[model samples]
Target: MSEPWIPIVMRRDGDRLIMEWSDGFKGAVTWKALRDACPCAGCKEEREKPADPFRILKPNELVPLAPNAMPRVGRYAYKIVWSDGHDSGIFTLAHLRELCKPLE
Candidate 1:
C-alpha cells in the first residue's frame, strides 16, 4: 500500500484553511466548507437528511464558520473547534486533503 499523505503545514487564514502536504501538494478550503463537512456522527446524520425547503434561520442559528482552534489528534488528524460551539469532528489528514482545492 502507498504511504499516507502527511501534512507539512496547516494554518487558518481568515476564512480559509491552508494546507501543504509532504508530497508538495498545496491547497486551501473555506472555513464554511470545513464546518459543513464535519465528520462527527451528528453532523454526518444531519448532512444525510434531506434538505428542508422551509428551513428558516433563527437569530442564534446564524453560526460563524470560523475555527476557534484546531488541535492535533495524535499524528493523523485535527479536532476543530468551531466558533459556532460545535467541536466534535476529528478530521483525518486524508479527509482534509480531499476537502481542499489546489491553491492558485
Candidate 2:
C-alpha cells in the first residue's frame, strides 16, 4: 500500500515559521536561517547573515514571521507563500521529514 499523504500547514508567526502537520505535530522555525537559505532571489540577495552560525545563538535573537501575511498555496506538495512576497519555499515531503527530526 502507498504511504498516507499528510497535509502540512505553514504560517509566519512574528518572524518564525510555524508548521502544523496532520499527525498533530507542530513546531516553529526561525527566520534567520530560513531567510539566509530562502532560495528566492530577493532573500538570496538580502541574505547577509550566516546560516549555521546563527544556530548557536539564543532563541531570543530570532523572531517569528507574522501570520497576517502568511501564504497558502493551492494543492501543491505543501508549498507556502512567504510573507516577503516569496512563494517559492515549497516544503516537500522529504524536507518536512528532515525538519521534524529530533535535535541533538
Candidate 3:
C-alpha cells in the first residue's frame, strides 16, 4: 500500500488550526469546528442524537470553545485538549485534512 499523507506542520493561529501536508496542501480549520467535529465515540453519539430545543444549558456548558493543547498519538493522530475539559477525540491526520478548508 502507498504511504499515508503526513502533516508536516501544524500550528494554532488565533481561532484556527493551520496545517501543511506532505503533499503540499495547506489548510486551516476553526477551533470550534474542530471540536464540533470530534471523532470520539462519545462525541459521535452526542452528535447523532436529536437536539432538545427546550433543554437549558448549564453554566459549564457555556464555556468558550478553544483548543488548549494538541498532543500526538502514536504515529497517526492528535488528541485535542479543549478548554471545556473534553479531551477524548483522537483526530487522525486524514480526518483533520478532510475537516480543514484548503488555504489559497
Candidate 4:
C-alpha cells in the first residue's frame, strides 16, 4: 500500500513550525528541536559524540537564534537557516511527520 497523506501546508509560528498533513493530522515542532534534530552528517556526528549529555554551555558561547528567511528544500523536503549560521540540515516530510506524534 502507498502512503495515505502528505504535508499540504506549513508555516512558522514564532519558534515553532506548524504543519498539517493531507490526512488531517495537525502538529507543531519547535525551531530548537528542529535545529537540534538536524538530519545532516555533521549534526549527526556531534550528537553521537557528545562528551557529556548533561553538560551545559557557558553563556558567552551561546548564539542568538531565529530561522532565516529561506526554508525550502525542493519538493521533497525543507531546510532551516538558523540565525547561528547553521543551515545544513534537511527536514524531510517523513521526518517531520514522525516528530508530530500524539502525546502519551
Candidate 5:
C-alpha cells in the first residue's frame, strides 16, 4: 500500500490542532479528544480502567491548548500543546490519515 500523505504544516490554536496534508487536505483535531487519547504512559494506563475508561477526563471536560507551542515529532508526528499546558499526545501522520478517511 502507498504511504499515507504526511502533514506539511501543523498549527495549534486554542483548543484545536490543525494539519495540512501533502494531498492538500486539512484537518482540525480537537484538544479534548486528543487529551483524552494522549499516548503517554499515564494516559494509556488511565484508559485501561474498565470502570471508567475516561474518568481522568470528565465527559464535559474541555481543555483548550495554547497555539504556537506545538512540537514536531521527527517530521512524521506532532506533540500537541494543550490549553492546560500539556505537551503530550503525539499525533502521528498515519493517525491523521485515518482521521481523514471517509466513513462508509
Candidate 6:
C-alpha cells in the first residue's frame, strides 16, 4: 500500500487533539467530534439509528467528561480511547487527515 497521510506531530490541547500533518496542514479536532464520529462497530450502530433531537444540552454540559487517550496503532492508525469509556475505534491516518479543517 502507498504511504498514509500521517501527522508529523500529534498532541493534546485540553479537549482537542492538535495535529500537524506531513503536508504542512495543522488543525485541532475536538474530543466531542471525535467521540461522536467514532468509527467502531458500537458507535456505528449508534449512528445508524435515528436521533432524538429533543435532547439538546447547554454548551457547558456538552463538553467531554474526561481527557482522551490516543495511542498509535503501528504506523497506520490511531486508537481513540474516548472520555466516556468508549475505546474501540481504530481511526486510520487517512480518516484523521480527512477530519482536518483547512487552516485559513
Q: Quick one: ranking by TM-score, best first?
A: 3, 1, 6, 4, 5, 2
Q: Model 3: per-residue lDDT, tens digit, 1-104?
A: 88789999998888899999999999999998998899999999999999989989988678768888899998989999988888999999889989989988
Ranking by lDDT: 3, 1, 6, 4, 5, 2
Task: Tell me how candidate 2 scores on lDDT.
Answer: 0.52
Top model number, TM-score: 3
Q: In model 1, what is the error at residue 95, expressed in angstroms?
A: 0.2
Per-residue lDDT of model 4, residues 1-104, tens digit only: 77646777777778787888898888888777777788999989988994886889867338546788546687767887777678888888788888874422
- Candidate 4 wrong stretches, greater than 4 Å: 1-4, 52-64, 101-104
What pairs collide in candidate 1?
A: none
lDDT tens readout by residue for model 6, 1-104: 76766799988877677889887899877777777777999889978989868978757556555446788898888998766666789988888877766655
lDDT of each: 0.89, 0.52, 0.90, 0.76, 0.66, 0.77
RMSD (Cα, Å) for all candidates, in order, is 1.5, 7.0, 1.2, 3.3, 4.6, 3.2
Answer with 3 or 4, whichever has the higher lDDT. Answer: 3
Error of 3 at 92 (Å): 0.8
The runs of at least 3 residues in candidate 1 whose Cα sits more than 4 Å from the true structure, single-residue gaps closed, are: none
Q: Write the per-residue lDDT of candidate 2 for residues 4-103, one digit (tens) a residue.
A: 4454666556656666767666766665545444555656555654667545654633544322343334443454454444565655554554455232
Off by over 4 Å in 2: 39-89, 100-104
lDDT for 47 in candidate 6 is: 89
Provide the clash count, candidate 2. Answer: 11
TM-score of each prediction: 0.89, 0.43, 0.92, 0.77, 0.63, 0.79
Q: At residue 72, what lDDT does model 5 achieve?
A: 74
Stretches of candidate 6 off by over 4 Å are: 52-63
Candidate 5 C-alpha lDDT tens digits along 1-104: 88769877766545566768788887776655666667887778868867765557643344333434567788678776655555757878787666543322
How many steric clashes does model 1 contain? 0
